[model samples]
Target: MQECSPPAQVAGRTPEKALLSPSRARYGEGMSRIDRPALGILLICAGVTAISVNDFQIKLLSGGYPLHQIVFIRSAIGLALTLVLLRFEGGFAALRTATPGLHLLRGLFVVAANMTFYAAVAVLPLAQATALFFVAPLFITLLSIPFLGERVGPVRLFAVVAGFAGVLLMQVPEAEGAGTVSPGVLLLPVAAAFLYASMQVLTRKLGAQASAAALAIYIQTTFLIVSALFFLVAGDGRFAEHTTNDSLRFLLRAWHWPTPEDWPLFLGIGAVAGVIGYCLSAAYRLANASIIAPFEYLGLPLAILWGWLVFGEWPSVLTWAGSALIVGAGLVVFFREGARPRPNRAARR
Candidate 1:
């Protein structure tokens, strides 16, 4: 799934290549012809909505199906959709790349991150899991220091520290009720976010070396392989028994044949994933990352809405407080980065 932010720009490129080359350019000529900021905002909103719906469907299926089985089916369908789109763009030629190792490493991170997040959402409230996932931007900031050689000033450093504090607050028990959350469960999404941030860092590293389509194909292929292995190992006799732990059961549950009535829902997930992935890439292409990145927080409210409508869950007081700090800290990093000066055209070459 496309996450909250676009990868940072690739380092060291000529001005002409940056503006004219399809792989190097932020958006193609068609997208550049429009009002970029406005179009970007709209696309980001649509992308966020599509992904939220996808998560809702995944959460619904998680109750009855094994996590790996669901990923296999969803990703297999999604890969078919991606291939159809790829044919229009340039067939298999568009997927050609020299950085196969980097792509595979990035794909591994994607698989780990998606599996962890799926496990988290299977047991936790959607809003709560999503809120914790927002800390990814903070993780990205820290990872960039070493992986991308980006410098962090004091203000952004403070944001990182405060953002983590928000994570801690989220785990605290409320005054009126006994905490229903298992402490171990909270770690799932946190680890997912860190892995996701690491994946984004790798995305930045490979942004110039590969097209977005190519990167996506690599990740989906990894998903297919990993999920299939899980299915082969656990889908047969293993599912004959049941586990009491919701998270463990979600992870290890055996694949059963989907009922005839439920086929459309499973297929629809692939379609949703396709749209979400496209819009996110398109959004970044159309406008500056700073302009569109903050809108990603829209996921939180959408999660709350779906949680209430579908599962009758609401955010607790601590959830609200924690979300505020997390969102505020993310905005701080975005704006600070936006305000920094960029190298001149001549310097870029």
Candidate 2:
């Protein structure tokens, strides 16, 4: 499936739930097999780790390189890896989309969402930025109603309300909290969450034409084009001297030639992006979303650990309180949805 909507991390869903065709709800995807669920958990654990490391390195490199430059290099490598992985799904033909316009629109929304979230990451503590971003589950829960014609029961409705309260709680951290960013800047992650959730909803309109690898290829291509455009317009770094804001600086700063020492980080994240997408794509296909969804919450703790280890940042009391609410609400929803009965692969076809 999609990366929690690429390996970026989702608020409340397994990557499979977010990216799978809206018409197909395989709550029991691989349940017939005993080993499958364990494998899925292991794959998600690996995926979360890759995403954490990737995010840490991106934040590390932000001070030295423009966001678009890093995106360009990362996407360039990831695109190649996705192309090779396409073989498993049915080759390049899987990319054939009857709804090109929908694909284009989705790719652009994903690009915008990533830009804002990373912008937040460059300035805020990784744990705080990620915790706030997990609000996407709230957004998706609401969006699915009108968009996918799905009904939200009173239980899920209550969960959405609580998850939203979590967002409000995080808005005012303790005085000693290190996760604080400018109030205006804090909105970036929320905005990204909205866009990411909206992208998932919009995908329902796309029909079941493209495979996960093919969809990833479209997104990487979008990243490549958008980053290239950023370079052509601002590679000179002339515009960067105007601001001292780290997030702005990260976004508009001039590109630089890669140093030998940093080359490995740049190349390595891209490779990891490819493998994460390919392997997790299969992992979800072989597992159930309900069982997998709770584990996906591991991303939050992983974010907290990375923030502490790499940047010496710690979550405030409010951050913890808010995360608990959001995560708890998401689990309720996932468990309920998972318990619902559904037909097997034959019925889906």
Candidate 3:
């Protein structure tokens, strides 16, 4: 731990890592020969697409299944897949870390983020949930100042302001539509964004002591344990019978065996979880986030596409305008951070 100094900014892993995708620590042994940044960009694009699909499937099943049930199933499959990946990610040694407490904290943060975001997704349109979730980056920018001791320039501050303004814009739901945005519904993903941003700061503090897969194993295991506990207590739907809140019902509903038709979707979600872990670990490690981070916004449009094609969802014009500002503000921050020069270590001494 003494050998690795803390990152001055929210560093380690990429934007995709905090996008509610599972976190996998990286060991960069395989991608040495290729152009790292190019590959990183490609991986990010692919990763964001996978996240969109995973969320879509979750949204589809939320009406019929409890949040914990779906997560429990997905994690069971995902953990097995990640165990297979662990062998390549330095195996048991990767899991050996002096900072086990930090790992535990990171895993909890991710679980908190996932639960809040998807709870919103179950009731809100996919585009709107995702749009609010993208605020994680803005959170990272703001959190970095306090957690990482980084200074925010005027440009980054403005970006953060504009991003929050966009979030406020997204708060007013269009028309009196069912399942559209509402006063409190918008806060679910926003809360998730805050938790995810906190997780990113912890990732920075971890300082590469943990590998991607190892960190993911922690999160996946945490998710499994937490979801299972939820099942033990709430799997019978007893608590949900009286609840009128759709989001609360989604969380409190009983678990059920996936129907034959739903099996493939569950299995696919697990498989995509694995793919997202790899793509993200390889991406942020291989390229400068400034170069690849903006592309993470691909999730927004992809979410829109998935919502429309699968669920017939179309975001309102207000949603559209808000999405643009959030994405644009994040882009400004990413480019500015990339262009800013790294301070010399020798000069500090």
Candidate 4:
């Protein structure tokens, strides 16, 4: 999961204000801990590593199964894991909220983002797909201004422009002899990035109204519902044909019974989702966004490693250059945010 809003400002107050406000008191316990930047970094790193593994497994399974079936199985297992954690945290009551509409909307975005991302990865090299998705933070910064009422300084705006430029560079076709990836294919991940960013913005908006675990459960529930619907509607015999193109095949393929050998990988993806989702939400909860945000770039390198070692795919030189710009621009925005002083409570209101 991407970093939603800044933890402190999620509920429209500082930690001190959160503690004093009765409605915000329950939320404060999750947010008021002493900042531990190192722990935040470790947690984020672990979270991303788990997500990468899940991606790798999805890619491996894409050949044999439809994307929706894979998602259904993975999400079903993940939901079970989430419910167990929710039970320990506060059970059903922890999930109660006045923002049910926002949760449903956020869940819709999650479904769109995950489905598009998986579609992209099914066709593109893992490194390339991951790099494209890294644009989410840029999208978040752009979205935050209107959605969260944050002011964007000129520096952050420049970073955003530079990051889009990087995206363009990555998509540009190589010289005559070099391999050419379809522009349409590249756009899927970009779309996913936007939806993911939108979902994060909503998450930030709801952060004060809900616990991290509750927010996570809602997302998992959305996944379960969407995936199940897709599986049921598209699982018919008419769509069973396998095609030469992996991406289309992944999207249009029909559901099939999972083999004994496939059960573990499917179940493992669910466990990974539970762990990654919690760690990500918790990491943002534990530290300032700027302090923990940069660590997300760690996913790019990990994607490269997996693409190379597992899939025998390496990003081209152009991909690396473009990735560098995107990563650099995101870090610049985060650092700038950190340098600004926190707004006064009255100012935030």
Candidate 2: residue pairs that collide? 3-6
What Cα-based lDDT does every candidate model obtain? 0.72, 0.71, 0.72, 0.72
- RMSD for each model, in Å, please? 3.9, 4.7, 6.3, 3.8
TM-score of each: 0.87, 0.84, 0.87, 0.88
Candidate 3 lDDT over 1-349, as tens digits, reads 0000001123333232223222222353222222367887798787777788889999989989998998888888878887898898788777776667886787777788888888898888888888888877788888888777778899999999999998888876452122344567778988988888787777764443456577567777888898988988999999999978888999999888889999999999888777676566566656666666777888888888998999898888888888888888877877777676663211100
In the predicted model 4, the residue pairs found to clash are: none
TM-score of 1: 0.87
Per-residue lDDT, model 3, residue 133, is 84
The CA lDDT at 331 in model 1 is 84
Q: Note the residue pairs that clash in candidate 1.
A: none
Backbone clashes, each candidate: 0, 1, 5, 0
- Give per-residue CA lDDT, model 4, range 1-349, as digits (tens): 2223111122222434443443334654433444666887788788888888888899989888888888777777777787888876667888887668888997798788888888888878888888888888888888888888888889889999999998888877761112554677788888988888887676565454555677678877787788778767767635546555556778778778999998899988889888777777667666666677777777888888999999999888888888888888878877877677775322211
Single out the weakest 10-residue window by summed lDDT for candidate 3. Answer: 1-10
The parts of candidate 1 lying over 4 Å away from their true place are 1-35, 175-178, 237-243, 344-349
